[model samples]
Target chain A: MSTSKFVRQGFPLWLLAGLLTACTTTTVDEFRQGETGIESHEAIVILGRRQGSTYETREEFVNCVGERVSRGSGAIRVIPEKEFVDSLFPWFEPRTAPLRTSDLQALMEEQVVADKIEEYGVRYIVWVDGQTETTNRTGSISCAVGPGGGGCFGFGSWEDDSNFDARVWDVSSFANVGTISTDATGQSYVPAVVVPIPLIARVEANACSSLATQLQQFVNGD
Target chain B: MFAVTGNRKTTATRSLRVLAVLGMLALLSACGASSLVVEGSYPTPAVRKIPLSLGLYLDENLRNFLYIEYTETGAEEYRVSSGQTHVQMFSNLLPAMFERVQVLESMDDAAAAGVDAVFAPSIEEFQLALPQKTRLDSYEVWVKYNMRLLGPDGAYIADWVLTSYGKTPMEGLLSVEGGINEATVSALRDLASNFTLSFGAVPEVRDWLASRQNVVSNQ
Candidate 1:
């Protein structure tokens, strides 16, 4: 069977996989330990962004990775985007590309920012950006309700794929350390009886976990 | 009645334990608040001795033993007076490394002491960076010094500035003050060692000391 046809046929099984895997499996495509040589056990910020929409998506992914980086990896601290941006760029807020290496260098030159960095001993900044979308959809669902009796039922399936890249930068040296990329793909199903029951594949969550793990590994020289 | 007596014993035991814990915490805090005096001396290096009067221009801040209290607002005003400054520490360290070194309080003292040359050392900067839970696993301390070698006639011989850093891993359960002081001691030790090595190794200093020795011999 063609790959697309097979994926369409395996919608139920994919939903089952989603139910079984509390955290979807993560696949890492690229993990380059950059040359900055920053210590792993230092505070690093995780930021997320996308070309369209606001910073909501970035915040969600940053929270996810920040939690895992602190808990799973032996990282001394993982700074979330909210804290990083709120403290550093309180007035102007854009996670993806507003701040560059030169901008950071200039900030570091400021006495206040320099003092803060020295106090916290921050080492690295990890910038994450990506998109997760429904790649394919198949089957159909329908529902109907009458005044005497109300009933609705439908069955449908869709495939979701998440792609994200994380770039690590050293705070002191103001240099890029490395990059980590992750791709997570899963199929979901929706069964509508009286109400719609959707089994959603945790594509974003899987990508976050994988990217965080790889970033930690890259920093710790693992 | 027996049950009541047993309960009373248990209550007494628990109370005693709580008291002991509180006492220990109190003791820890008291000790943590105290300033640290650097103890011990580095072994004199194997080198020719230079007889000179050393003038110490100690910064007022370095005169007090300093420690840090890791707080939300960062470390502030935790200093203790120990009757000695970092200059005095250097004074204590120099006698061992040099053949004959006299601590001169002023240029007048150097002139009266009939010393060929004088060395003036001043603290440029001092910082004790305490470790934080989410930020750092190691404590680091930094010290910078601006030094000048001058003749008793108030003529400058040479000038040099040196910055040294020391770091140590944060270990055990103790007060932030204690941890920072330990790291500071390490940094001071390294700074002293570097100073001694540089003092003897610098070409200009070596020549100057050698010339002073030759002048003394001729006289």
Candidate 2:
């Protein structure tokens, strides 16, 4: 191909590549120490801290982490957030309030709670807490609903940042073992011209994977 | 002047091509989706004192979107919202059905938890659908699950797969979002019921339980 022809073809390809790269930007951070004494056969229950009407946990983020932890950590089983609630909600309901590790011991003292724990063979309970928010936004987009379907026009951009922390508590000892956290930020852009093109960063998903991997490593003590 | 005109034409052509490519991509990506939480409890068999360890392995896609197929355009896209994720559905509902079930967060935790055996579930095929172009219609969700059973020693006991379906009618009075949530609730309930029905009947699981019982008796 002529140099001019090559330039014409290569330019768009480069631009496309750049756009794709910009879309997938994510940072995963974690820390851990020696074997935390958790065994492979034990169970870790991930719970969401309730905040009034809503829970502190994000459904997508929790599930993502649970899936990754199960897959990444060999055969290590993860007690999903849903199961955690099903198993523990009854005890929690009495309080009509949120629970901290401090409250578990007293509850554990109860025969029913203790029996349930032993029955379930729960080793550690992980509490996930955090939220994702739009940190910043600049630009505007407008839409018009016409008889012929509908359309949006203009350009809009927003930045979403997610901050989450995973706290591990050993059920047997009723002690807090360690904590892992993730802070992921994603930017979204919408360019509307008859249609809107959205570029979503998936920051929460990144946070999920990061937290899950780190929690696995922390529990495995590897 | 001729050379200048030729370069301008090339530039314009390149710009148009770029715009065309972007436009196509945008059009293809027009589908919108949302996620919902699946909530509810299902009836399980009688309580067994011997605790069973349960593990869930969800497909990453299930955590992301609900796949909806448009009949008009013959286009398939992951564009349904869910209140609860696939992981949440299994994790939350499974324990309710069983009396002495331990839902492990990680496989490593299972060994220490003193579980006799483990159940690992993975998604095979999952889809949620409603008639295309109609805001008011019944919504349906279906899933195929691939399951694996392992002993405490990590021995592979059994591998099986099961499919389940759920449906809910959309009331015209409710908003579109509300209808979607109702559908999700129904789908989750059916999936949980299906799990209890099939999982209890698995021979490998029975064998494993018997073996575990023997070990307990000896101890």
Each model's TM-score?
Answer: 0.42, 0.46
Which tens-of-lDDT digit does each residue in B1-219 have in candidate 2? 999999999999999999999999887667533334444443332223335455443434445545454446565433454424556666665675444456665666667767656667766676766644445346666777777777656678889887765555553525545555566665655566555545657887777668866876888
lDDT of 2 at A203: 74
Docking class of 1: incorrect
Q: Write one digit per residue (lDDT tens) for candidate 1, span A43-107.
A: 87777653343222445677888888888536648766655553543211332234567777865
Task: Report how closely model 2 matches the true complex, as a DockQ value.
Answer: 0.02
After superposition on all C-alphas, the RMSD of every candidate to the true structure, in Å, is 17.8, 18.6
Q: After superposition, how far is residue A162 of candidate 1 from its true place, in Å?
A: 1.5
DockQ of each model against the real complex? 0.01, 0.02
- State the iRMSD of every prediction, in order shown: 22.4, 9.2
Candidate 2 lDDT at B71 equals 46
Best by DockQ: 2
